[model samples]
Target: MSRRPPDGEAPVVTAIVVAFDSAHALPDCLDALRGEGIATIVVDNASTDDSAALSERRGARVIRNGRNEGYGRANNTGVRAADTEFVLIVNPDVIVQKGAVAALVDAAQRYPDAGFFAPQIVEPSGRVFFQPRSLLAKHLTNPGGKLVLPEGEACAPFFSGACFLMRRSFFLDLGGFDEKIFLFYEDDDLCRRIADTGAALIYVPQARVGHGRGRSSGPKPGLVFKSRWHQAWSRAYVSRKYGLPDPAPSMFAVNALKTLAAGLSFRRSLIERYGGSAAGALAFLRGRSALRQEGLS
Candidate 1:
């Protein structure tokens, strides 16, 4: 059932945190959201740990999946379950700063035509993480350039999937994230579609969230390989889908050669990195679906 506030009350914004074995990070993430008095929903993607139970204890509505649905699909589930007009999608490894939610809400109202609003994501070391370039432009035009921080409220090329606020109706209209993506490049795909509709993707620097980047999945080598593999596959898929120059052929050749060298040197991590990309590229070239990749998960 949808959780909505009374008609006369202020518009409610729900925070959706998609968790997968993220018990280590959920407490802080959920606690910050609860502290801000924002309703939160935690979608557990078949986590082997107590992520679901922990979220419930933290006063969050929990949705438990029987099997691991990919990140985008799990987020789609959370967004659908939310009854609010606006929803904040955040990673489990993120701690929402005080007033951040309100800042995003304000930005939403200020930019009525925007389909998405993103908070400034800060790393543990206090470095700001903001990518102002579009994916195509970054790769094709400026391969190496200094990252520039936007001032105040500004239009963004694309917001990071790690943390962002999106209108529920606009999200639903775009059909949410593409489920076929499974993991990586889902944000790029969504942003591309939003651009098609000519809706702005606003970046609100006043809002801030501390992100423990790459900590949600932990440091399991198997998980690392899985992430790398899906990243390559998803990148190839999105590039092809949007008529961008396909990188699968070149990716496959380079990674395949590197994989052979790494295997000869007995470098396990390098083997995983190079071999995963090679396999992913080959899979895409052969018309294999990312979701159907066996033994990776």
Candidate 2:
């Protein structure tokens, strides 16, 4: 992490990109913001790849963690370092569309009661993901373009996690995302809290961000297991924190059956999904809020 700013680094909005071995997809992300005067902060979550250096070369302020601090915590560090009024939190795999930052900033006036602004998120497959419909749908499986908001409906209860712009003060007041979530549902926890405060989470289609799905976790058995376990743990914790009726027992039953079927059919991804649900149910039983680093290290 830099204690000193690199020369005269002046940016209108501080954009924090949380990276974990993200060197492969980072270039395109940075290129989209070239000369945009966005104070880019790349918080490298103990990535072994050259992510920090690559970001530094692109004039981004780099914060290299000694070890992985998870997504929410890493973004918190960048938010703390930000001096700008506006802050954009993004993942390294996200490509910001032209004028997106400005559009989000401009839309802030239209939504005077908003706590944050989310842009249209397009997947590599040309599909929409995590749109406003996802606020209460409670994703049971791959959301894969399942939710859509009509052209006129702009106010949303919640927004996607990949990219969003918000007032720095609003984020600080919420104490940022709950770090206890570790790897998943941190956004859900934060967004719901904002809604509870009677603040709108507006979705602006004019501002768009392209997302490349799941670059960090490749399709491997062990990694998949790690992701599933954490996903389960986080979902359970979020449900409890928000006072949503516990779906643990039902999730466990359905997923256990799915896991058995997937195992028989050799569907590794589905197997992991079911395994995650089972693991989450166990997490709910244990009242665990955070997941310990295990095979992932």
Candidate 3:
């Protein structure tokens, strides 16, 4: 049952889900948000599937884009359309658990200085995914650190882009996610900016959500290539933007060699992965636009 706010009180949060070809997982995501009485806006990034229609039928206001606007830009569109004080940015693969939205709102009320509030994300197997580390640690060191679940509300350097609640005014004031980044690392950039402003990125263990990782886009080869390409491009872009060590030079060389080897072996998948990485790095080195023309077919 959907719970309404007290009489004379306005709704506190609106959920924003940016959809590509996400019809498969969108229904459950919308259902979960509706169950919490949260108004949702589905920003359809020119999905060829029935994502927009399904969202509208499920009672979410749908914003249809003419073309794929990538993740950050589409989210910015949704955030701008929302009227609530706080905005819940959720991926189509994430199911916001019962009371999770309420918990995030309560945390926001308690931590007035926080710009972002993230819930504990669990996998289907019940494994908690909570890896919080500084930008330097992420780039300079091995990122596969031990996972220690937070006992309570904890301050994090950065939260996953999968799901989070953020102050609407603060988000807009910061210009939302950097549109220069087509995909990936947008969260890191946002968190860094929030931290620079002396605002907190709080992780509330009381709130939980189930994340079906990488389910937003289907397993098409072109989509996979696009993801890998953007991952490398965005990583290099963020590193350079923040004055971190440039990974492009080394990444390009290593991935180029790997791609050549994979080509010789006729390993199609490896070739795609390594070739995409190499191309992305070279693009970054050449100062090419991050928003490439290639997109999902």
Candidate 4:
């Protein structure tokens, strides 16, 4: 039986934090959720640290998995356990400002048609990261600075899943993230799937969340490599799924060019990494390699 939130109670908002060795970020994340009076769910993916215990101590309902499940799978696990009407899937590294959660929930409510809603995303330094927007304009604009779209402009190219909230029913109906995409493109895939069902993803400028950039990736080179590798592989998967213009052949060609350029540029490290990745990409393009899989979470 499904657990139902009491009528007239603040719509139960389940904030799902998927943690994998994220001891440092967990407390801040849990505190933000509890501060907002949002029910918190922490899904620990086999953290070597005392992450699970810490989350429980902080009053978050904890779910422990013996093995590391990649991002998508871990999130799905949390979503499945939630009993809320609205679900806010957040990264452990994000800090919710006062009223951010309420604003997101209100935006979703007001925009009834929107499948997902998120606020302006920013770095800890108060600089705006690219909030969700159409692909063309997003790429055309410079990376930093506030991007205010003109009235009637396309608001969303895709939903920003990193710190967005969605209706629980709509989220589950879409079957959650594509498990095949272990990392990067899973968010894009989810947005596309929502669009396929004719639901829009809205950006609520009123809401705001501060993200610590690369909190998981920056200090760890191996994890960074895995992230980039998964990105390349998931790009192929997205291209295949959404019928985006064929990027494999071009990506392979570009990687080959980069490998040569790196070698000529006297960047030995770049050459080593790009050369191997390019070789794998070429093999993929030629049907000589298997579809890349996500590493254990």
lDDT of each: 0.86, 0.77, 0.87, 0.72
Per-residue lDDT tens digits of candidate 2, residues 191-288?
77887788887888888889998974224446676677777767766766667777677777788898999999998888887887787677667665
TM-score of each: 0.93, 0.85, 0.94, 0.82
* lDDT: worst 10-residue window of model 4: 132-141
Model 1 agreement with the true structure over 133-194: per-residue lDDT tens digits: 65643232334645878777787667788999989989998999998988889998898888
* Least well predicted 10-residue stretch by lDDT in candidate 3: 133-142
Off by over 4 Å in 2: 1-10, 130-148, 216-221, 261-271, 293-297
Per-prediction CA RMSD (Å): 3.0, 4.7, 2.6, 4.7
Ranking by lDDT: 3, 1, 2, 4
What's model 3's overall lDDT?
A: 0.87
Q: How many collisions per candidate?
A: 0, 0, 0, 2
Q: Which segments of candidate 1 are over 4 A away from where they belong?
A: 1-11, 136-142, 294-297
TM-score for predicted model 1 compared with the true structure: 0.93
